[model samples]
Each structure stands twice: as C-alpha cells, then as structure tokens.
Target: MQTQLAVAAYIIHNNKVLLIHHQKLDLWLPVGGHIDQNETPDDALLREIREEVNLEVEILNKLDLPVEGKTKKNLALPFYTNVHSVGDHDHACFYYVCKVINPEKININQKEIKNFDWFTKEELNQKHISENVRNQALEAFKLFEKLTK
Candidate 1:
C-alpha cells in the first residue's frame, strides 16, 4: 500500500466554516489536495485553498520566526493530523485552520468541486455532515475563536 502526504484547510470567515462537496470523493470535506513534489506543506495548503475555492487565506497555526540560520522558513503547524484510507491507498493529511482574506472571492473549481457551503456551529450537527468532519469543524470553530479573541 502507498501513502501520500496531503494538506487541508478549514477556511473561516463571517463566523462560519467552509466545506465543499468534492466531485470525485462525493464527500463534504475541507479544501485540500496532495502536496506536489518540491512544494512545502505551507505552500501546498495555500495553493490548495486558492485552487479549490479561489480564496486567499492566512494559516492560523503558524509561528512567526525570523527565516535565518539553517532554517529558511517556518510552516504552519497542523491543528490535527491523521492517516485514512482513500480507496486503494491512504493519505496522511495535515489539517489546518485558515482565516479567509477575501470572503467574497470564493469561486468553486467546478471540475473538482460539486458544491460548497459555510456551516455555523449549529449547522455542523446536520446529518449530511459526517461525524468526523463535523467534529473537526466544531473544533476548528473553537480554535478560530480562541485565536481571534
């Protein structure tokens, strides 16, 4: 079996969290994709968000440090991480919470995304949302609130 590294983002804006109905996976999930070779995880996350939703975002779990010495860059720490089966293979995914920079600029990539919605706290309990994703969304809300406040 093969495992791949991936990045995902729960984009927040206007007191709501974003989820997309993935066309291929047919699941409501955060905007994300496999990290391309030669791309940093931080870059992969930002690129995924932009490609999936056409939105700009700032990763929230990032640490600000001088890019110097042996370390040239700092990447955002994933709030949660897990390995899960995606059909024949598995993905070790890095999950992040991001603050949307242009909330009004979201345009779905129709080729890969079927639909999109912003879920509030209460809305996260809806049956259509998977338990795992719903719980993560709830946690993302808390993290976002904690960071902003």
Candidate 2:
C-alpha cells in the first residue's frame, strides 16, 4: 500500500472556522496537502495554508495533534487509518490551530476549490456539511474555544 504524508490546519477566529469547498470531493474541508520529501509536517502545513488561502498564519502549538513516531518520520503516511477513506494512499495528518498572522487579502485558486467561507459553529452544525468535515470542524472549534476560555 502506498503511503502519503500530509498536514492540515483548523484556522479559527472569533468562533468562526475557515473551510474550502473542494471541487473534487464536493465537500468542505480544512486546508491541507501532501508533504514534500524534504520538509517537516509543520513546514508542509504552513505551505499548504499559503497555497490554499493566500495568508500567513501563526500556528499555536497548544492544540496540535500528536505527531507520529520518529521511526515513521520519513516514511510515507498511511491513509487507510488516517482518514475516513481506505484503499487510497494512507496519510497521517497533523492538525493545528492557527490564526491569520498577516493582513493580505485572500486570492483562492479556483482549480482546486470552488469557494471559501468562514462559518460559525452554529451554522456548520445545522447545515449540510459532510459527516467527516462536520465532526472535524466541531472538534476543532471545541478545542479552540477551550484554549480561549
């Protein structure tokens, strides 16, 4: 089975979360992508945020997920268990809480996504978001709320 390494971020601000409407999946998801061969998960995540949102973020380490073992550092991340889907390339995602650190306007690339939006938790929970994304958005929001409170 092929493995893929990836990193994701739950960008939060004022009880709102940023999500992208994926063109392929037709679902909203946090920003993320495959990790390059020479970079760390943190680096890959930051790069993905820049590519996806056109903004710089300050990653807060407090709410980040546990990293995979050091032995698997350079190994391909398995997607079977890391995500909701299996048989596809496996991936290990590093989820972090982040805030926009710069004031640049967003310029989303239309090739990978349809649109982007910032939604409150209330709107997300009551809307038609995918099950996986809904759960993730809720969890990320909960963690973020905890940190601020």
Candidate 3:
C-alpha cells in the first residue's frame, strides 16, 4: 500500500457548519483533499479551502487520527473514517478545525462539489443529510466550541 497524507477543514459560522455535496462521491463532506508531496497538512488544507471554497481561515486545532483499519461508514463521521488502502494507494487524513474568515462569499468547486450549505446543528440532524455527515459536523462543532472558548 502506498502511504499518503491528507487534510480536512471544518468551517463553522452562525451556529451552522459548512458542508459540500461532493459530485464524485455523491455524499456530503467537509472541505479537504490530499496533501501534496512538499506541503504540510496545514498548508494542504489552506490551499484546498482556497481552491474549493475560495476562502481563507485560521487553523484552530490539529486533530490526530491514527492510520489503521479499513474504511467504515461510522454513523459518526462526515466521510468514511479509517485509513484507505487499495491496489497501489493508501492514505491517512488529518482533520482540522477552522473558522471561515468570510462566509458570505464562497466559490464552490464546480467540478468536485455540486453545492454548499451552512446548516445548523439541529437542522443538520433533522435533515436528509447522511448520519455520518451529521456526526462529523457535531464533532467538529464541539471541537470549535471548546477551542474558541
């Protein structure tokens, strides 16, 4: 398995979490992507945010996840958690908590993302959004609240 590093950013505003409807995966996920060969996870996340959401943010915290296990659809994840390993590809992703500096203006990546929305925790819980997505949003929100306070 080829090992690779990636990063994800959770951006929250007005008691709502920013989520993207991924075009390829056909699922809702936090904004993130693979880290480039020379880029740090932080750098990769910042670049991904700018590319995917057209916004800058301040990294609030670093979330460490050990790389192991196969991908599982945990009811408590935005995307499938656990490391991914295939024929020639393997990856472990780091998740980060960040606050969008500007929420009013966003440029969604049309190619990979179908739409973007800010959903309140309750609304998200009640919506048709996936259970995994809601769980991840809540986890990210809890982290945000704890760090910002």
* Cα lDDT tens digits for candidate 3, 1-149: 67777777779887888888888877777898888986766678889999999988877753445545883322112222446542367768777778889876799989989998888888787656888667877888998898788
Worst 10 residues of 2 by lDDT: 72-81
The lDDT values for all models are 0.92, 0.72, 0.76
Q: Number of the top candidate by lDDT?
A: 1
C-alpha lDDT of candidate 1 relative to the true structure: 0.92
Q: Give a tens-digit lDDT track for model 1, residues 32-99.
A: 99999999999999898889999999899778888998998888989999999889889999999999
Give stretches of model 2 more than 4 Å off. Answer: 62-81, 86-88
Give the lDDT of residue 118 in candidate 2. Answer: 86
Q: Where's the lowest-lDDT run of ten residues in candidate 3?
A: 71-80
Best first by TM-score, ranked: 1, 3, 2
Candidates' TM-scores? 0.97, 0.77, 0.78
